[model samples]
Target: MRTPLTAGALLALALAAQPALAKGPATSPNEAATARHYASLIAGSQPNMAELTLFFTQMPKGGDLHHHYSGAIYVEQYVDFVDRQGYCVNKQTYRIETDKALVAAERAKPAAERNCLSSAEIYADDHTWRELLQRWSNKDFFNHGALQPPPDRLFFQTFGYFGPVSNSNFKEGLQELKKRAIAENVSYIETMFKLSPAVANPDFDAKAWQNANDDAAFDAQMRAWFAVLDKDPAFNKTIADFVARIVDSSEGIDDERFTMRYQTYVLRLLNPSLVFSSMVSGFKAAKSSDKIVGVNIVGQESTNISMRDYALHMKMFRFLKSVYPDVKVALHAGELAMGDVPPEGLKFHIDQALTVAGANRIGHGLDLAHETNATGIMQTMREKDIPVEINLTSNAFINGVEGSHHPINLYRKYGVPYVISTDDAGVTRHTLSNEYVLFASRYKPSYAEMKKTSYNSIRYAFLPVAEKQRLTRQLDQRFADFEAKIARLAKTAAKAP
Candidate 1:
């Protein structure tokens, strides 16, 4: 479901939109003039793409709330990391098939039995390198025929291919994300990441919670599961290790200067026991660690396993909430579409996520329009003040939903809060800049409205109340400075010979 636009079509559209800019909101006379100036420079009339890009790139994007660390990182960076660790790639699968430990284990065995090759051995040829890039991301993917894999499969399968490389490149990967985020003028990031592996519960009774008939029974069942999990010495060690990994990954970054937070997650497609155990460990980690702020459920929401266990997972979060009251939950709900799943499937995901699981924020709430009592749901969201993290590129690429079909305009109409974000920039081959460009060019929001959405990200973030206040102040100063710079640039251009 990647943007179906071909390269030639995109170029043609860009060249064709060179007449006038859409009219933005009216404000005070001075402010309206500034808005007009800002619009003019970034409008389709601006012939220089570089200037338009720069104008928006330098514009302060307050924060990105729905980032995935592994997906946020450039795949080439992971390739470089794999090569640095002396790991090797699979030429056929184009996957990072070896890790440092695996290589060491291979060395302990007979040398000739090893099944690995150097990065150079695999990527020495230009064709091989291009194949690897295609395998790891959705770049230039429009030309593949029906004989080739579908777009969703190509996009999701890349995670499995680069899983090993990303697992080992935490520090370098974060540095890459930080560098890019800074460049795009994004000041804060609430990126989803996981460093925890669950220790299998020997006495796990998977059926105890699965067949519960009522909320009370389900709550009791999960409480029993947690009671047993809390006693595992090895399980406790996993939580500590997960927190240590985050701190280690962020050794030199100053939170005071550049803000960042982690949201550890449970893979929704996994077995119930594994997912539940991961959820416990993740929320426990968040309760104790300053770095990990919340928990989320990952994997495609429309998959069979996830769809079946969706409410059960929400119930699990509801139960865990009583145990770890301090921990936050931001779920990926309503990423489904009528085209991809049955109409009935979209009815209550965002609804249950908000009302049942007590989600603090919702990510990719694309099916909001299809929910049962959709207007009431939007009303509840406005009342609860929970924000939706809108990933324009991800939604468009994954569900083929954008522009009018997208619920963003509805969200605005109903007074629901939403923040713009880049869900998987590396996978989608886009950036925060690309997202802003889409929003500005498509929605034509005024300078104030644009800045307000940026502000919404920090306001609804799961940080401490004190930190939120500080960030709000910081954004005010940053936006003022950026507007001044843009104004000067506009004035200088007007007087040009």
Candidate 2:
């Protein structure tokens, strides 16, 4: 017993003498009480989702930064817009029938054969209503044995069915999103609202394709293209009009308590020329209006054009960013899985998005583990303070990436920052609260970490410093009130049998 202690024993004794490191920032009494209550709830082998849902529903989620405006609106609301706009749905295809002659002709058929049904007609038929909901969203997609396309296909295709009505009723749709966000204690939203107009140029495409891999040559060619666009009045006018439309659509969207900003996105599935031109337009729109806070590229990343020109698109973003360095970018990089594309495809998207495209934030960084130098990528993100937007429900539905297989575990292990978000709440038929419930039940993150994630949403937002500070202050008060309520609830429960 009195013999000399071994080196390992001595080191263990020294370390044990030191106090434990705190998990997160110091908390107020209410926060401490709330955290204790939350830990107990998630401590069991199977966490109580119902209780966690109620807990997260009352929690203050600072922002939803990865939302899509079209995808955020529920199918019920879109159907209402169809009724208001006098559009009929093709029952057979579930597509919006916009042609007057076609609708009239379809309406003339017998009730059994009338394929075009008005919104009211569709609602009256319970079977059609359920089917429409299933088509437009993830409703019953897992519960029923319906003939289904691939999950990703069904998810992306819903947009086309609702596109005709998505652009109309912007004010109404925005207000609806705002109302829902506030109800769930979300104070800010950065939504990818729409794509800026783009033009196709065969010559530009040829030149860009030629210099795709040569940075110096690509930069020169991009500058030449920019010069041409700079002098084009029609092109300049479109940017101005796009910005103006965003400004107009965002009327009454911001208030003392809530804020919403738009990101003008470019469709990556287009030709190189169109993609570059749209990227240019989105940058110009962001520069022209404060309401348009960022530019993003959104499309199915596994598509032929998107995959073939992926490197070129990053170069385009890099070049444009050189010119307009202040315009923020949040890209949908690594929104893919193993089977979605060839193995090589997953190895570079998240890396290029950060290093080449200069994305300040990344949406769906799902393929992080698949990237080459994956640890190095995570380290870079950690050192640079870049956060990934985690969409638990969306990733689960589309990519079958959830639980232990999800890269979020890797992110946590590597100290990379992440924020929970509802990528397309309406499309997934979930809410930010539901997202938090999933995060809590699955990851069992401490309340302090959960609160930090709420802050991270605002911190990584494409907002000015002052605006972020303002929202942060608001979040502080909201959390105080929320924790006090939770503390009271805990006290009451303690008194119960």
Report every candidate's CA lDDT.
0.77, 0.89
TM-score of 2: 0.94
- Per-model TM against the reference: 0.87, 0.94
Provide the lDDT at 110 for model 2: 87
Residue-wise lDDT of candidate 2 within 1-497, one digit each (tens)?
A: 02333557544543442222126444688999999999988998899888899999999999999999999999999998987887899887888988888877877888788888988889988988988988899899888988988889999999988999999999999999999999999999999998998999999899888988799998998899999997899999988888888888999999987999999999998888999999999998888888999999998899888899999999999999999999999999999998999999999899899889988998999998898767666766766888899999999999999999999877775567788899888888899999999988998888878888899999999999999999999999999999999999999989999
Tens-digit per-residue lDDT, 197-292, candidate 1 = 665543443673445447787677668878887997878987887799888987765465578889999898876678788999998889888888
Model 2: how far is 58 from its true place, Å?
0.6
Worst 10 residues of 1 by lDDT: 14-23
**Predicted model with the maximum TM-score:** 2
lDDT of 1: 0.77
